[model samples]
Target: MSRLKLAICVLDDIQPLRRVGSMANDALVLLFMIAIVLVVMAVTLIGGFYLVKYLVERTFNS
Candidate 1:
């Protein structure tokens, strides 16, 4: 009976750990999503900056 109780206690402790392991995966996924968004925003801003620069140069110099 005591061994059975001990087994149950061990299983209870492991249960949360197993759940945490599964949930921890979301952290990595969230980081990747944020990184992709940032890269896209950076590329968009860079392209816009060049477009503005070209327009200004063409309008003023030509």
Candidate 2:
């Protein structure tokens, strides 16, 4: 009976650690997604700026 109780206690202790590990993984995935979004936004902004500048110059010059 004491052995069973000890086993249960060990399991309980491990459960919280498992939850903490899962939370850490979720946080890492969120950070990765945010970084991807930032990179895409930066690329779009730079491309858009050049496109608009080219169009304006062409329209005015022609």
Clashes of each: 0, 0
lDDT minimum window of 10 residues, candidate 1: 19-28
**Deviating ranges (above 4 Å) for candidate 2:** none
What is the lDDT of every predicted structure here? 0.96, 1.00
Task: Provide the global lDDT of candidate 1 against the true structure.
Answer: 0.96
RMSD of each: 2.4, 1.0
Candidate 1: list runs displaced more than 4 Å.
1-14
C-alpha TM-score for every candidate: 0.69, 0.88
Per-residue accuracy of model 2 over 1-62 as CA lDDT, tens digit each: 99999999999999999999999999999999999999999999999999999999999999
lDDT of 1 by residue, 20-47 (tens): 8888888889999999999999999999
Score candidate 2 by TM-score against the native.
0.88
**How far is 42's C-alpha from truth in model 1 (Å)?**
0.8
